[model samples]
Every structure is written in structure tokens, then in C-alpha cells.
Target: MEFDLSWILLGLPLAFVLGWLASRFDLRQLRAENRQAPKAYFKGLNFLLNEQQDKAIDAFIEAVQNDPDTSELHFALGNLFRRRGEYNRAVRVHEHLLSRGDLGPADRDRAQHALALDFLKAGLLDRAEEALKPLEGTAFESEARLALLAIYERSRDWPQAAAITRKMQASGQGDFSARQAHYLCEQATAASAQGDEATAHTRLTEAMAAAPQAPRPRIELARQQHRQGQPGAAVDTLATLAAQAPGALPLATPLLIEAAAAAGRSAEALALLGRHYEQMPSLDLLEGLVALDRASGDATRPGRNRYVEHLAKEPSLVAATQWLATEQLEHEQFHPQIQRALDQAARPLMRYRCAACGFEARQHFWQCPGCQTWDSYPARRVEEL
Candidate 1:
């Protein structure tokens, strides 16, 4: 063993030389691959900037093939495919990323999100839901839940929409109380249509509790009570509506007057009507007041005179038409022709217009039928706005 010391020293130097050569060989191979990857990547970037997406995709695919473990390049390719409406290709690229065992948690979540988006854009909602569900506890949770909420809404799955909204509210995404109230209202309406009065009542009550300041639930509940032969209850509900959400009273003027008359609450009704008219004069409210006054037959002021008074406050063609129609003209021969022409001109002015998209309808909507926006319509008519 002592005689082999010189041989051991010589063998150590030879082994070190071989090791160095092997390291250099591996580094050269890695550098060559890295150089090819960047060149392909830059080519892809150039094509992308030039708006040559198809060529960019080809270059990106080449780059990804050269650098197979590059999560970023795979993401870029997947997103580019989606932007080009090549959803199948995007899904494939993302699916590949998800299948890789070496992919980090963040990249895996990103691929899952991309896959869901692909399915959503392609109208494969069922697939999208499956893809998005696993991302619930990830950083993509909020966005995933929002997408799921939209899916449920589009499918008219009110229960699912409510569940998602509750979760989002719990997460402090924003106050979803109003939207949850709307969901309950929708469920109530559906229950009412199906002759499930008890369920409808419960749902409407929940909606009211969910959004105490929301006017629709109270209004709807009053209608339900009136239909169920509970005029007293209906009147009481409307009284609460008048006190709590007075800004919405004009829109419900006719219903309130009817309910009040049914319950024999004329004095209370008159007081509420007068207060609303004084604050914000609406043509509908004025008409309701005239009807209530006429019904009471305790008319201190003429019912038609309210129209004239409204005209004094605002140069309303609608009010002028109403006043003139209620009067007998001395020139009776031309009165019919004048009335017909005025009515024709005022017809369009009575329609409700969406403030968001400028779409007009003959009736007011809580949600804009044109733009699908909630509470976009003002309580006032087109002429008032």
C-alpha cells in the first residue's frame, strides 16, 4: 500500500482532467440549447409585435420545443392561441403544462385558470366549471368564483348564484348583498309563478332582509299580499316602502293608491302622495293623486288642476296634454284633432330610456333589458330626465 502513493497522485490528476473535459462538454451543449431557445423566442416576439400571430405561434412552439421546461413560453403560447380563437389549441397547451410534474404551484394554477377561460370562451361551461373548481383555494379564487357566478347566472341557476355570492361576500370581494337580494327576488318570482305561495313569501322575506334598503322586494311583497287578499298587509308594506325608500315611491304610485284604497287608508295615502309630489314631481304621481282625490270625492282642488300645477313647475308637454284633455274646448270642432296630434307627439316621451345604452322601452325595468345593467333606468320618464 505504501508503494502505490505515487500511482495514486498520478491517477488523481488524470481523473481531474477528465472531469473538467466532461463539464465543458455539458456546458457547451447547454449553451447551444439556450442560444437556440432565445433566438426562437426573439423571433416569436418580433412576429407578435408585427401582428403576425400565426407566425408568432409557430415561432413560440419552436421556442417551447427547444426549451421544453419553460413554463413562461408555454403560457404565452396558450394565451396567444386563446386570443386567436384557437381554443382547442390553447386548451392543449395549458393541459400540457398542467400535466407536467415539475411545474410549480403558481404555474399549475395559472394553467388551470387558462384552461377554464378557454372553456368559458368556447361556451363549454360545464368543462369550465370543472376546471375552475379546483382553483377555489388558490390565488385565482376570486376570479374563479366570479366566473362561476357568471356561469350560474347565465344558466339561470339562482341557488348556485346565491351560494357564490355568499362566498364572495364572506371573502370581502365587495358587498354582494344587493345582488343576493336580487337572486332571492328572482327565486320568489319563480316560486310565485309555480303557485308556491309559501315559498315565494319566504324568499321575498329573505330578499327584504338581505337588502333592507332595496325597494323591489318590498314592492313585490306588497303585490303578493294584495293578491292573497291581505289588503291591510299590502298597505302596511307600502307604507314602509314610502318611509324607507321614498325615492322609489313614484314608480309604485298606482300600486300604492290601489292598495290604500283597498285598505281604506285614503288619508295616509294622500299624505304620502303629497309629500312625494312636493319633493320630486312625477307625472305618474300626479295622475295617482288625481285618481285618489277623485275616488275620495273630497277634492278641495280640481283633479285636473294638478296637471296644470305640474306644468307650472316644469314645462312638461305630457302635463299640458293631460290638462288640455281634461278640459272642454270652446272650439270643440278642432279639439279632437289637436288632442290626437298631441298624444302622438307625447307617446315617445312616456317611454323609459336606459341611462347606460340610451335604449328606450315603453315600460320601466329594474334591470336594463338592452345593456343588462341593474338599476340603470331612472324612475323619471324620458321627458323628465
Candidate 2:
């Protein structure tokens, strides 16, 4: 029980010295680990900047292995895999990140988004949809919903696309009324093809109601009415369209002529078309005017004469061809060859072209096949545009 003062004093300093040395060792170890992680990351970044994706991937893998807890590095690696078209590896990396309990809520959401992107890029739409569903109510909700909408559209799932669009509209994404109307029109088209005229009519009516100013719904509804042997109703629908969406009358010209003739309202339809042509002077409108004139037996200026009038206004090859078709050349024997050459030259000008993607087609499309853009194609023909 005797106290030793010297030994007590010596032990105190030794304990202090040991504690200081331990702290120094820990700091040095931490600095070394940090340096190693950054070295690998910078190597990866250098490789990426140099366009050496293979080496970049290798370096990123090394960095991830060295700093397993780094969520940012994991994300980078996952993205690189996806960019390289290694979707499986990208999916696995993101899934691994999700499985880790230490991940934060934000990181978990990010990883889930990355996994969905991987599935989408791999063309596994079903899996992508499932993965994207959980992102609702999160910060990534808008992005996920947009992806889902695209998937539904690509699959031609009109109802699902409409539902997603409605949600987007509700969330203040933008006004999707026109797009919703298009979906209903697509549904009507399918129903009509299946011989469900009643359903098609209902859907077309709903489409018209959804977007009163949209031209497609009225045009489609009129077409459906005409097909169902209701020419008078079709004429009425087209007349409303002419008053409200007159800019789109050219696209609906042929339909109008047919409906007018069937309903015994050729004169009224001709007057409406004449007014539109006076304002816009579209070739389609002029063609519609000529058809109606011929149908009504106009003697002063025949259908073919309208072409010469159009040629006077616009120096169009299409108009020239139409005018020449009705003319009797001095060398009547060579008329056929001349007409054929002119027709061949004017054929391409009749095609509709997309303003967004520069895609040309014989028929106008509400959505572009090349770029999947809605209302990308103008109603005007290539020459007119």
C-alpha cells in the first residue's frame, strides 16, 4: 500500500505520449485513404476526358472498390456502364447501391432512378415501368412520369398514356389537352377498325369535347359520321370545324367534298372553301374548290381552270402540272409523255414534311414516326412549307 510518487509521475507522461501517438497514426491513415480514393477518381476522370471509356471504367471500378461507402462514385460508375451500353452491369451496380442499408434516402432514390434508366435503355419496358413506379411522390416523380408516358405511347396504350398525361397536367407540367384529345382519337380509330362504331363515336365525341379547338377530333368525328351513313351530321361537324379551325381546312378538304356531295350541300361547302382559299391560298384548298365546282356543274370556270388561276398566284410546279393536264397541246401525241414527266417531278412536292425532324411522308401525321414528336408536321405540303 506504499505510494511511489516517481513511478506515478512517469506513468502519466507515458500515457499522454501513447495517446498523442495513437491520434497521429489515425490522422495519417485517414489522409492516406483519402489520397488513394481521389487518385483513383482523378485517374478515372482523366481517362473519361481522354475518350478512353474502357480505361475510365476500369479506373472507376477501382475507385468504387477503394471507397465502398462513396455513393457519388457508385453513381458515376453506374452511369458510365449505362453510357457504354453495358446495361446489365449498370443495373447490378445500382441495385447493389439500393441494397445497402447505409444509403441515404436521396441516394436510394438516385440509385432507383439509375436502375430504371438501365432497364429503359435495355428495352425492358416492363421492368423499367415497375422500377419507375416507386419514384412517385419523390423528387424524381416528374422525370419518372415522363418516362412512363413515353413507354405507354410507344406501346400504343392509349388509356395509360391519357392517365399519365392527365397526371402531368394536374402537376402543372403543361397543358396536355391536345395530347389527351389525340389519345382519344387513337382509341376511336382502334374501335372503328374493330367494327365498334358506337364506341368509336363516343370516343370521338369525347375527344372533341376534350379539346374543342383541336382540328383532329372534328375531322375524325366527321369521318366516322360519314362512314356510319350520316352525311348530314358529317357536314354539320365539318362546318363547325371550318368556322373554328379553318387553318386546318386544307387537311380536311377531301373529306369535306365527299360529305358535301353526299349531303346535297355542295354549294354551301364550296362557298366556305372559297372563303378559306381566298385567305390562305393552299393547293389543297384550291383542289377542294375545283372538285366542288365540278360537282356543282359550274360552266363559267371549270375545275381545271382553277389550276390556271392558282398558277397565276403562285409559281408552283404542282399547279402547272394540273393546268397542263387539262390543256390540249398542238402535239397531242406527245401530251402523255409530257404529262408523265411533269407528274413525276411534282410528286415529291405533294408529300408532307415534319418541321421538327425533317421527315417527309405521303400522308400528314399528327405525330412524327422519326422523332415521336406530336404535331411536328405542318398541314402544308413540302412545296408550300
Candidate 3:
């Protein structure tokens, strides 16, 4: 019934030997796992470099399986899936990272951003918006705000777009004053459509105050004034615009002529247009001058003569076509066919073009419908460019 001291001494050494063996086995296993993970990672990288996305994804999945705690591997896998248009897989991977309680603040934000990108790429706008809103004060704030701005613009949510632009302005991201003006103009258009003329005018006024240098609000305001039987007000607005943004005179010329004719100030409008045309000879300005001269009963100089005069400044096909219409031709019967061909050739040259994306349109745009860029289209026409 006595404890054996011999047994205790024997067991102590035996236990130490067994513990050493187990520790050695664990060390070997850990080394093997470490080597395997890196091997898989490098294999994935090689596949990625070779542009074999499918193979790279397989390798990355193997690496992630080999090292579940490797956040970088998970990120790579998620991004690969996202790029491969595997939104469900990308969302799941990012969501899994977010679910981990051991993740640091920065990694958590990254996971959230990745999740938002997945939703955005998948066209799940509502989900993307929900995911992105949480990244407001994070490092991804600017990118998130821009993405949100695009979403609002695409959806035509003017109020939300305006709010986002204001936030971007306050953060010193960029000057969104012009964009803010566009949003107000959009709101004004909506108000005008609803027969709320007072509200429309107020919004347009706010828009003009927001970006005094912007042309859209003033142009829109003038159009509204003309519609409301305020021709003098419209002419005054366009005259101010011509002074402020002389380059935009081409776009405003047609409106100015109409307003001036309505207000009985055709002579003053013609002088203003001529002054700008002298500085920058725009086809639109030349056309405006011709229209005004013809309307004023000035037979001393024909409108066709203005096209001939414009030809002296620039070799415009449009101008030549116009001049050919009234010129004395030896074969007057063939003039119709020749003029038709010239008109067809000059029509495309008369289109307004986007400076950003090269999207040509018959009319000028404040924003590019193709690239979703604001003020991408120049004030001048394609031929002028």
C-alpha cells in the first residue's frame, strides 16, 4: 500500500521523451504547411502572370485551404472571383472575412469595400449602396463616394446626387460646383415638367448662383423665360452668357436670335454675335449673323455672302455648301445633285463631339451620355475640333 518512488523517476524521463517526440512532429508539420502555402501562392501568382485566371483561381483556392488564417490569400481569391464575374463567390469570401472576429479594423474595411465592389460589378445597386455607405469615414471614402455618385446619376436621383456632390466638395475631393449646377438644372427640369414654374425658376437661380461660370443653368433659364413670354429677360440672360462664356456663344446664338427677334432687339443681338464671331469665328455665330441680316431686310449683304466671307477665314465644307446653294452655276440642273452630296458630307461635320470619349451628337450636351462625364463635350462642333 506504499507509493513507488522508482515508478515516479521512470515515468518522468519517459514523459519528457514522449513530449519531445510530439513537439518535433508538430514542428515538422508546421514547416510542411508553411512551405505548402507559399508553394501554392507562388503557383497562383505564376498562373496569374500567365493570364490563366482559371488556373490561378484554382491555385489560390488551394493556398487558402492550406492556410485558412491567411487574409491576403482570401483577398486574392475574392478579387480573382470578382474579376472572373463570380460575384456570388466573391461576396461569400468577403463576407466570410467580415464574419471573422479576429480581423483588424483596416482589414475589416477592406473586406467591406471588396464586398461592395462585388455587388457593384454584379449590378446589385441597392446592395452595393448599402455596403458602401458604411465605408464613409474609412480610407475608401472617396472611392465609395464616387461610385455612389455614379449610381445616383445613373438612377437620375438628383437630390441624392446633389448631396453627394456637396459632401465631395466639403472633403476637398474636387470642385463639384459644375456638377452641383447640373443637378439643380435637372431638378429645375423636373419642376418645370410638373408645372411648378416658380420652383423651377428658384432651382435654376440656385444653380446659377452655385456655379456662375457654368453655362447650362443660364441657357436653361433663358429657355424658360422665352417659354414664359419673357423675351427681353431671355435676351438679357443670353447676352450675359455671351459676355461671361464667349466660347459658348455658338450654343447660345440660335436662342439669342429668337429672343432678340421676339424682343425687337435683333440689331443689338447681331452686334453682340458679330463681336464674338470676330474674336472666335464659329459657324453657328456666322449662321446667326446671316439669319439676323436676312430678317432685318438688309439687301446690301446677302446671307449667302456671309458663308462666302466665312470661307475666307476657315475652309469649312458646311460654309461652301451654303454658298453653293445661291451661287450662279453653269449647269443649274446639276446643282441640285451636287448640293445634295455636299449637304450629306457636311452634316456629320456639324455634330458636337465629346472631348473625353469622342461621342458625336447633332446637339451639344452638358454631360456625356456615353461616358457619364460632365462637360466632356466641347462648345464647338466636330468640324471646328
- List ranges where model 3 is wrong by over 4 Å: 1-13
Sort by TM-score, top down from the best: 3, 2, 1
lDDT of 3 by residue, 1-385 (tens): 9998999999999999999999999999999999999999999999999999999999999999999998999999999999999999999999999999999999999999999999999999999999999999999999999999988998999999999989999999999999999999999999999999999999999999999989989999999999999999999999889888788878988999999999999999999998999999998999999899989989898888899889999989998998898897998989999999999999999998988888889988888989989999888888888
Q: Which is the winner by lDDT between candidate 1 and candidate 2?
A: 2
Query: Relative to the true structure, how large is the alpha-carbon lDDT of every model?
Result: 0.91, 0.93, 0.94
Off by over 4 Å in 1: 1-36, 46-52, 293-300, 324-345, 353-359
- How would you encode candidate 1's per-residue C-alpha lDDT over 45-117 as one tens digit per residue? 9999999999999999999999899999999999999999999999999999999999999989999999999
State residue 78's C-alpha deviation in candidate 3, in Å: 1.0
Per-model TM-score versus the true fold: 0.83, 0.93, 0.96
Q: Pick the candidate with the highest lDDT.
A: 3
16-55, model 2: which lDDT tens digit per residue? 9999999999999999989999999999999999999999
Off by over 4 Å in 2: 1-27, 330-334
Worst 10 residues of 1 by lDDT: 366-375
lDDT of 3 at 334: 92
Candidate 1 lDDT: 0.91
